[model samples]
Target: MNIENKIDELISLINYHNEKYYNQDAPEISDAEYDNLMKELIKLEEENPNLKRVDSPSNRVGGKALDKFDQIVHKIPMLSLSNAYSGQDLKDFDKRVRDMAGSDVEYVVEFKIDGLSVGITYNDGEFEKGATRGNGVVGEDISQNLMTVKSIPLRIKEDNEIVVRGEVYISKENFQKINEQQENLGLALYANPRNLAAGSLRQLDPKLTAKRPLDIFVFNLEYGQNLKFESHSESLEFLSDLGFSVSPSYKVFKSIDDVIEHIEYWTENRGNLDFEIDGMVIKVNNLKQRETMGYTAKSPRWAIAYKFPAEKKKTKILDIIVEVGRTGTITPTAVLEPVRLAGTSVSRATLHNEDYIREKDIRINDTVLVQKAGDIIPQVIEVVKEERNGEEIGFNMPNNCPVCFEPTVRLEGEAAVKCINMSCPAQIRRGIIHFVSRDAMNIDGLGESIITLLLNEKIIEDVSDLYSIKKEDVINLERMGDKSANNLIKSIKKSKENDLWRLINGLGIKFVGVKGAKILAKNFKDIDEIMNASEEELVNLEEFGGTMANSVVEFFKEDKNINVIEKLKKASVNTKTIEDKNSNVPKIFEGMKIVLTGTLPTLKRNDAKEMIEARGAKATSSVSKSTTFVLAGEEAGSKLTKANELGIKVVDEATFIELSSLSSKEEVESKLLL
Candidate 1:
């Protein structure tokens, strides 16, 4: 066969295997065989770029990086479903649906996948566009990113225009693997699979999105040109036949009671599944009935989501221990008997502080009810006092640092007991770890274990000491080879040029977080200016309070901290705030408080925030009456609603961009008036 024919054959073969392995979870060929086929296709495509098919399986690896996602207005709004928390709520929903429509209503039940919702459009059997379900009415186009998902078929068998909706998710196993990789790399681990999947899909680089293990399950046929389906179940079957992955557990039920029973069973056994599902959705099966029932303002009247409550498990607290953080704050943790909760084994939970423990009356050997807060951090919710025996021992906060034997002091009106000794080993180790963290100096190859080794070997005494280390100091250490040591030294040297905000955050000053550091950096030109600033001067800055100002003053007052700053300066570290080159841009948004919501059409949220802040606007997280305007995009949620309710001004990405380009505040006001 010719090269063209060979390429087509290879594409067909790889797509078939992808469907089998990813969609059906059944592989007919070995991974190596599949890989070899893909390699041959990639080689052929590289040799003959003009002959590469649009639906080539090679696209599953990634495409060109996107400058920004374009806005796609969905033909039909992707209405959210109202939630039902109890069996009675489900019954009420059924009664309401039957009362509105007919008594012969049947329901299709499927898992309410805890993932990002997206709409994919296909034209003449080939994938055209894919977009996030932003605000239901509009979404950001993510076609390139969606093409990277192996389960999402690039081409279908049928030859008609179709729009299908699905949930994109990362499997629990993949989530664990990704977190492990993050831990090894000394990066912040993702809080949950849902967030990771959402973030992955929204990545500016399709290659980065492709690196994540993403999967999708199509649930709805939103639009089909000249096609019809009798019921929701029928459409799902059609989707599955079209080589799309559909939920395997969906079932049609004639009785609402049966649906409730099924939901209950899944709620109890959701842990068995590899993917996360926060609830179950019950939709009116018949298409004609759904049309008649229609939708509410924000949700469908023909369907309701039965939300599963946060899973709580009973476990015994074996002991309580306190850990000193980088800032020297003491945090008490409960060592609990290992119990499975939210698909992970829980062996410990945060007791928060002394007040929390005293109020909860938690004790060692006491049976406690533990649950994952937002399916991430494990925390003790309630003490099972009825199950606790009299033999349980109450615990108290330590009076001294466990690691350094230094006296711990609790400040007035503060819950945290802190180790004030600046040289505490625990504090030093944690501080070094923070100094090399991603948001700080971002020195790669310096994970916790490596830092611990360096500290033990006496090669580094503090954060400043890291700058003076030689290649010989690390090359002979465990897990450190010549190349690794060289890379480490280069990374350490490169970090000296980071912006002033990073250095301030790395200092681990009390009450000065990332945002606070940015605020400080914006106000002060260098560390010396900040050190000389009075508490009143700090308090006068935006978002700074008396407590934060006092913390900054007290931190700089210490002779040890001044010595460290001198050392950092002596090593040629950049301490001055780097001024933006675009200084000509007018501060049209000066003194205006803006809240951003949803996905912007042509800008990342952070980029938009930084742009606004640079132009003299404060980007707040929530909408309030005091908000000057809300920059809303597709899928703007509660913030948009609240903005509307409070009569706060709202602007789109276009308007915000226009305002940003205005020469003066008067021009901005004139534009808004127009």
Candidate 2:
């Protein structure tokens, strides 16, 4: 074969094998064979630069950097597939497809791999670009990480322009292997494969991407040049021929029963597969037929994922215990006999509340069905009544604070048992921890470890004493140095000037959050006004529930808390609301929802929320159209995720600070009467 022909053959061979290696998880060829083919293509492209094409299998590693990256608008809006929870929902989807395309319509079904979705660009047979499926319009460029997937070809076999969409999944086996390695190396274990894939693919550098074991399966041929395929089935075949790992084993059905049968066939066998398959994606096979059907605001009209029922396993409840939260509410936890389910060893599950325990008749020594709730937290899904013994002991939520041994009480119509004592050691410590957290007052060098050190040393007993830390004592502490100590002192000093809402949140009062603090700050302007207000006064505030109103009133009524408030005043923590400020800064986001991301330049993120909310805006962690602004900074993660998804407006720190006009927003309210 000619050198050019060899390059073409290499691309075809790699994609063909990649489809097996990634999608099918079955490789007829050895890794050595795959490596040699890649080497041949790389050498050919290097020897003849003009012969190099963007879509060449060799280009999968990445492409040329741009002066400014332009967002590629998807030709067809990438829509999220609707989920079918039951067989009936699956039948409904089949019915809808039938109504649109008649009994003659063919459908394609693929494993809904629990992973990240991305779009890959191939120009003239070389992989040129890849990006996350961000809002289906603009995605973060992830060409580097996508290339690291051994299954994704650097180049394609066909000499044509193409943009194929696919899922990037970290196999459960690979995920466990990486986690075990991370644990051995003393790195934090990623929660699961999807989060790992997401974090890995979003990395800016390819060198880092090479570290993670990722795999890809091409499903949609987003764009095709010189490719003639009328139906999705035909397109998949052509793409497979060109060396892409298309989905396997989709059965064409004239009736819903066949589609239902296909889904039922996989549900039991899905577990037998090496990779995770949460659901089966059913879609119209014909491309033109899809266009005729159209779309909804979020999902496609033609496709739906029939999710497999959550896996449940019977496990014995060894005991029940209550864990005190930062707010001093004791939450019930079930200590279970260790059982392997849904990827990890399950030893404990949450009972949610006392009512949940009673409602389920859950008892110590009783075997129950435990499952990953929402595929995240482990919980007892149902009681295995057949196995229940009469000798089993019923479990009860604690009547006292687990940590402080103080009597607890649940309010009317509420399920949580709250530790009413403000100075309950658990309550105070947890509150102080929250106060110094990154989002709150954000005292640098004041993490849980440092707080433990401070508490053990008896250097600081309360949140007010946190402000009174001596630089010499802090520097002299073990595990801290002069430079770090100095920087920490500087950060702590900077934090003192933050708005009052940070103080309120850090206090860890029940029913008061960043948004709640803002409502109090804006309405009352000072803590004194809030303290003087009764439950009736609080209930009058917008969005303040009766329980929240009572909680606020009760929190302020305590003499010890009142004394702490006075101490906070003595330390000059910001207690004055900006509603009283004469600054001309217009609240661009009055009553609008806002999310904070990354580390801010000037204000702690929670402190920034305090600023935004002081102007009558509300702060939320998730972004939506209701979101007015996203304060973005270095390493912004989830809020950034939603901002990109919802197309929310984003701003830098200087702009946010400029918008707040709070150069002096930090000045303390006033020295309270002491």
Candidate 3:
């Protein structure tokens, strides 16, 4: 066959199969076959650049960075929920419903996704826009990124304008893979799937987002044609019929008992699924009843989320080990008989305090009951005293640090032990890992194995050594090649440009997180200034606690740390620049954390985030107490409840725009004044 014909055949074949596999979930060709064909096409395209179409099969791999995030105003106000944390909470909600609406209320119970909320708009059966739930009223548009999700339909069935709400999440497998990549790259791994999803979705590069296996489940119809479903369950079915991946674990409950039972069932049995569920969402199933119920200033009167008790399981403690953390915390890890829990096998649990160990009587070779502390981290709930043999030994934190072999000590009212060793191998390893983490420097291809290889090979020791690596040196290593080396070196070089917060984070200083790092970096321009800062100086910083201040003080006091910083400077790693911090006028969210959910009536999603950032505040992608406000538009899901529970201020779209606008107007005035 002629080369021209071969190229056309390859492109046509790949396109056909991509649609079949990604869109249809029916692969006419195996992944290997698909990969081989794609490889051939890529090679061909590389050889003949003119033949490469802008919308070529290879372009589907993803594209360059987004110029800006568009702002979207949700059509509906995604309202918050009054949560029922316990059985009584659920019962109380039921009682309130019965008292108000009087006993005949129907509710639809759904698994509350521990994920990011997104809004997708379909106009005339074509995908129009997708946005993050930015301060509920406004969101950042991520339509291009959202389109890459295989489960999300590029086109919906209905021709009229249709808006759908969904929870965009990374599956457990994808989360793990992403984490592993982060670990390999020498970047900090996200604590959980929710974070991974948020981080992945917000990535400036759509190609990176596309590579992540993100899935969205359409659960609500915010607007548009023929979505006249009377109940939440019915709406879900209608959405499913429209080629949307609707979460199927919903149950229609007449009485509150059924709601309670459904929550119990999932709490005990969510391990079977590929995703994670933090709690159950119960919404009034009747459309008329829901419309009648309406919404409060913050939450919807028609809907309530019944959170599951955090997952916990009983297992035998096989051993107890005191490991030294990078920051010199001597933490106690309970090596337990492996038990399946919370969608993964748990073999260890963290015993936060010696007092905790004493109170719970955590011991080596003892039976113990552990609980997932917050549907995320595992902790020992209590000792299984009845099953424990007399031979079971109680654990005491060590005298010497596990890594540097220095003396370890615990302070009054403090649960953890500290090792003052800055050069401790464990700390070094963890610090290097953290330095390369996504939230930190985000150095890809720097995982533990390669770090170990570098360490073993004596190619480099500290993070600064990363800069010293030659491509030939990297390619010479086993499994490392010309491409891998080039990519890794490029990634490492790219990391130097990540903002001050990332550098602070990458430093692996105790008690200095992304938020704290930013504050410190802002206060003290460079590493030397931070190191010179006294404990009281650090303590005086806004929101800094004495314990945290002391930790920071101690971290800097170490000799090895000073050396590392010097080496870092020598390596030319940029650390002092506060990225995008040049707003002449400040917005309410300038440096304020914000969470967006539901549908916005106006504005594109990215535009909303950019607006928030244009003023002085940092636009965070998730909801937490640190978050100053939640801009809720229409159909805000779980995050609405999370904001309420965390006591973060919740605002409607109007309020959001008004606050954001105030900042802009102020900025205009400030610019004039300047």
Candidate 4:
């Protein structure tokens, strides 16, 4: 592509990725890839200033502020840092600092946390406001969401009006957990921790933000009216002493060589940390030196960031094969010569789909670049087409399913080809595995190995067969003991008594997950009711989209599915809501709209929602003028904030429990209104 076309394309692509990363919490490309694009665009713009668009994404630090929250105009702008990509750049920076300060300036090097930047202000030892770094000068007020992050202290030790800057992030472990939950719900996975943290903090409901494991590291004491410190490290120490989580290990260096050494050390050890760090921040330690060094229009001249290189390797594509998932989608895998990447030996990489392969012109015997996406899944980057010496052969997708030999089909406007055969063995095996997964039926002692063994022995042909497996049949399998067999049988039986939503989720219905199953179960009394419900009826319910509704209706429409349901019924599995066994209990809070906030004393937030839902009250996520009351718990956040502002009645958890225990709607109303 020519320079102008490439610049335009990069602008469009970066804007799309910015929306994906900041607003949607899903990114199609890796951060390094996005940064390279930005760098190329910037280079082109610098070379040809007339070609730059007035509204180019390169001009912005983040996505536009969301309108769901109040806007906060920053008292002091949150400036970006100029970056130094190599040792020479660092040396140049050190020389500039020395020239400006007229001395050998000490520098503090700290990890540049990969997360959303925010400015938090405190008044008289209490947190007053928290805002994101939206366009640097203006930001969205996210005080409630910030409060949900446990690492941010609501009340500091010092009684002064102060402003601090920090990075809000999610831990790698929590990011994995959240992605797992998303996969179970059949939703698109988040790309990385930074995106997830930003999306979580921007949620309109503080309750939703509370569910995300977000943390913060205070690095800059922007405006401390009553506090005075000589150096950046001293300010960090004061912030840490006031219970603010500070950045991880940092050091003072007198030479640029030492700074480069620290950067190299972290480049090699970045994977060791629980949180993600894209680079290291090198700053002039002395506050006076920083003031003298001063600022540019958008970034500070006193500080520089050294970014790590993208990790990639070149390998040969040995072959491409397809695997059928539980949902019947055929995914292509690239078998390759084993190569080490990100501390793992990767022999296979994801091709994504047929479209991706065709777009990249990937062929057999072709050399291709590869990288570990998110430091987890391996993926092919691009083909080295020049290396092909007329030996590479173009690939074609199979016309039939690999496992069952059933005719495969690609739906219109969709990229994935799927096997529609209900009884495909691959589908059955994967579905059974999912059914016993912890997020589904949660059957203990029933793992993939035992299921595979049972399938091979013809003891179970499908999920329904699992419920009917006898102890004698299980005990006969290899590595099966009497005690193990009994435990397995007991576990299977216990699963039969799980809430109807579990059974619904365990059915492997496409697009209908834990949340969908709960909505279905609450609306319909039993499996039969759900099976008979029309698509319109399903779609009419809250949280049910048109596609999800159609999937549910189509899944139950199949005679084979009906047969499985019959088999499950014959095995005495409870297909109805088990929690609502007491039909005699009155829906005392019927038609009432209640909002729950903060951590309850003895009940989880979800459990509390269910309890209120059982009593015929709607458990709304956000507070508004229409809300009946706010159930305030310890550390009540933004919901309580808005509720009080709107003159809505707010009650303690004790009062909430007392009102819930009331037997009649009249008594409940009287107890609250009186």
Candidate 5:
């Protein structure tokens, strides 16, 4: 074969492997083998620049950084599917389709992945952009983040522009791992994998998105410039051939009975899959038939989704227990009589707190309704009062910390009863763990086990002691070799130079997160300055409220805290805030009150608010007549309705983005300033 022909063949082979690995989650070749192919492709492209293709698989790693996503107007609207709650609903949908398109009807059935729906656009087989299905007609651009999803292809061999729709999801395994990390870091647990997946997809940083184990399964060909396919199933096959990840278990059935059978099979066996699937999607297979049946403004009449209800089971609460968290907050848990739920044998479930138990009148020895929340966490849905016996005992929260025996107090506005001891063993261990975490000081070689060892061995009492550890001290510990010890010492030394916000966040002051810490650090110059500040001064910062300000003041007032700071200061740890060079940028949206609703095209809800705040605008939560503007996106829902009723000016996402970039607010102030 000629050099040009060889390059083409290599491209085809590489694309196939890319689809097999990224999309299908099955690799036919080893990593080394794939690397060798990529190596050859790069070498050939380098030697013969004329033969190189812009959309080649060689460019899959990454591309240019996107400051913000640009909006994309989908050529064909990505309509949602109407839902079918029961088997009868499915039959009715089939009848409607058959009545409109004749009895020669066929249906394509596939799993409806519980994830965010994204529209991926390809220009002449080159991967172009990926967007969320914002409002069917317009979607937020997330091309860079989508490119980070290994399951998504950067380029395809098919030389035609096409738009395909897929669900971007995280596997249950990955979700569990992420939650575990969050739990270890003293962070709030994610509600479910679906929410996590959506949040990960909308992340402003593609680098962060890449760390999430996101996958995609293409299910529809929304639009194809020059492509022709007779049926939906045919189009799926074509998409697969073109190096796209198509549905793993798609089947075409001529009879409604077959479609119903398929849905039933999946409903019973859904737990077997690695990813979460909320329901089964049944679509009319014939393209011409679909066109004839048409749409219903928001949803397609040609298709309907069957949603599976949450799985529930009954179990007895054997005992109630309280566990002290890192921050000393006590959480109540029910030790349940082992019951099988959603494929896993759950032995225990969280009762939340004393208030939850009291509200439900839950007692030990009472039978309760148990469910897998989001098919992940085991939680008590409610108490089964009818099954409760007189022998069941009422429960109450302890007056003292379970671990430290310290007097516990509940904050005025919060439900949690907290232990106030600064030197509580559990708190110290948790604090050290958080301090060395990725988002904090980021001591690479330090983990919970190592920190625990250090604590138990009396090598460290507080976070500052981490900076004082010698290599010899760690080398003698379990699993620590010479190289590991040296690395740990190096990482510890490196952490002293972290930004002041990290140190503030690592301190775990109540209500002071990364954002709040950054605000405090930026407002004040150093740790000593923050410690010396009054509640009034702390509350003056935008991110700080009265409660938060009080918490900071309280945290700093402790002798132990001051001692830790002194130790850190003596260790030469960085305590000074690094000033943002752009801090002096003109406040373009000054005095403007903006309310954002729904999901914006390219920006996450928080990202949009941050941008608005950066531009000297106040992003409020509610929409009223006083709202300078309501930035609306797809599924604007009640907020949009309220904005319209209140005579608040509403702008689409594109207009909002454009307005945000305006250098001056003079025109806006004249038109809509409050």
Candidate 6:
């Protein structure tokens, strides 16, 4: 076959597999096989550039990086939906619809996906452009970024020009993965999935957007040239038939009462879904009825969204306490009467700081409304002042550190009250915890509990003392056996050989995280070099601001910190750069299917998954016959047993690390095969 024909065939095959994996959730080919096909197509396209098709699957990897997105005026307005917060509000909407369109109206209810709205246009069965829903009429063109979403088909079976509206979103699982990556890099966490999805889609560089996990659920057939549909449900069916991922829970209801009942059911059960939905949309099923109902000034009269109320509970604030952090920042926490919230028991909530408490007038022995902020963090929504009694007492920030009794001071223009004593036991304890975190020195078997125990037992004084811990000392501790103690000592020894960047992050330097540490490690040869660097020099480095530079200089200037560093150096901990800073990670596990089970000693499940995926491995949730390896950790359960029964290779964290260190695919294969 000709090169062009071969390319076409490859594109078709890849697209098919993509749809199967992304949309259908059933894949016929292995990830490696799919990757090989893509590689071949890319090679052919590079050789014969002019012959490359616009609808090729290779476009999903992304194209040229753009400095800015062009603005596009939407042909049809993307109207917002009127919301119904209560059953009465929904009933009122139903009554209004019945008054205009008659009592025989059928309603189609679908999940109101909490995501960014976008419109994709197709011409002659090929994707033409995609734009965001901005101001209802105008939007930024994000065609290149939209093209990277695999669930979005590059070509469809439809011949006529059409515009489809979809909600571009990140799944809850992928959102957690993204946050894990952010935490590993020491970046600020995104508030929620909707904000993250919007930020990702609006990224200036398509390559950056391509790296994010994005999916779309096409809901409305916005425009279809020379096409007619009898009902809204029919149009959705047509779109689904064209390989578009649509709402799986859309149902037609005969009565408004039934619609409200379904909405109530979903309102309580929506947490079971993989994606997020803020509400349920009730739309007139009949297209003719929709036309009769017509559009309002801002939203459609025929459709309304029944929004779920933020789950809140009234609980008594038992007490307010403060805790010292690694940075010596004292944080106020409210101990609450245990209440079930967002499917979990909520016993404690962050009060943020002293100013927050003063502003909210939070008190001990007072009733307060509590809710999960972004459905993740428990927070005090408001105080139930009406229920306050004479016994309730307003809480005050501590004048001194609770643990070390050092005088606390609030700095100018800062909300935090901090204890400046570097040798404070609370600060040291928290600092040691930070030092041994997965993103820092990555010492396994030294969890927060273990660190606390070691501190209270006086087995270790600070982060530097961890390297000197003996297995015999650990074995004598309560609940620690010979094997556990041995593992702990080994992990500490292993961490001493870690790269300079990890050591820098492990230092818990003010305003210097993993990403900043990497930048410093890349620019400077050793920790001493960084310590000696001028603030002006640091400020000039990429991504470093004046505040961060000052913080770095200030942290290194401390005599206590210098003492700790000297101790670490004496213990022979690696403090110098060892590898090329800009080198790409080898895809040692490429084409491998790995399953992770139980509690990993050093890495969280998501962290381990992210690490493997970075090195080109598919980390599956379940063990299967095709699984290349089962990475079993402490307390491994059914998955590990199943892997053994299937005769699949079972590896521990140490073995996994050995496999990851292999430089070539051949080396990885040989290791796995053995």
lDDT values for all models: 0.89, 0.75, 0.76, 0.83, 0.83, 0.86
10 residues in a row with least lDDT, candidate 5: 57-66
- Model 5 earns a TM-score of 0.64
Cα deviation at 404, candidate 5, in Å, is 3.0
For all predicted structures, in order, the TM-scores are 0.83, 0.76, 0.67, 0.53, 0.64, 0.54
- Per-residue lDDT of model 5, residues 488-587, tens digit only: 9989888888889889999888888877887888888899899999999988888689999999999998899899988999999999987764467568
Per-candidate count of clashing residue pairs (backbone under 3 Å): 2, 19, 65, 0, 2, 0
Residue-level lDDT of model 4, residues 559-623, one tens digit each, is 98899999999998989876555356689989999999864544668778877887988889899
Candidate 2 per-residue lDDT over residues 299-381, each given as its tens digit:
67888878888878888999998877777788889999997566566799999988888889888888899999877799997
| Candidate 6 structure quality by residue, lDDT tens digits, 213-299 | 999999999999999999999999999999999977799998888998998899878888888887899999999989998986557
- Span of ten consecutive residues with least summed lDDT in model 1: 580-589
Question: What is the lDDT, from 0 to 100, of the residue 421 in candidate 4?
Answer: 87
Tens digits of per-residue lDDT for model 3, 547-640:
8789888877778777877887888888675645545655544455667775554655656766666665666678876786777654566777
Q: Please list all clashing residue pairs in model 6, or write none if there are none.
A: none
Error (Å) of candidate 4 at residue 343 is 4.0
- Residue 134 error for model 1, in Å? 4.3
Off by over 4 Å in 6: 16-33, 184-187, 313-320, 323-331, 335-348, 352-369, 372-378, 381-674
Clashing pairs in 1: 134-635, 135-635
Q: What's the distance in Å from true for residue 3, model 5?
A: 5.0
lDDT of 1: 0.89
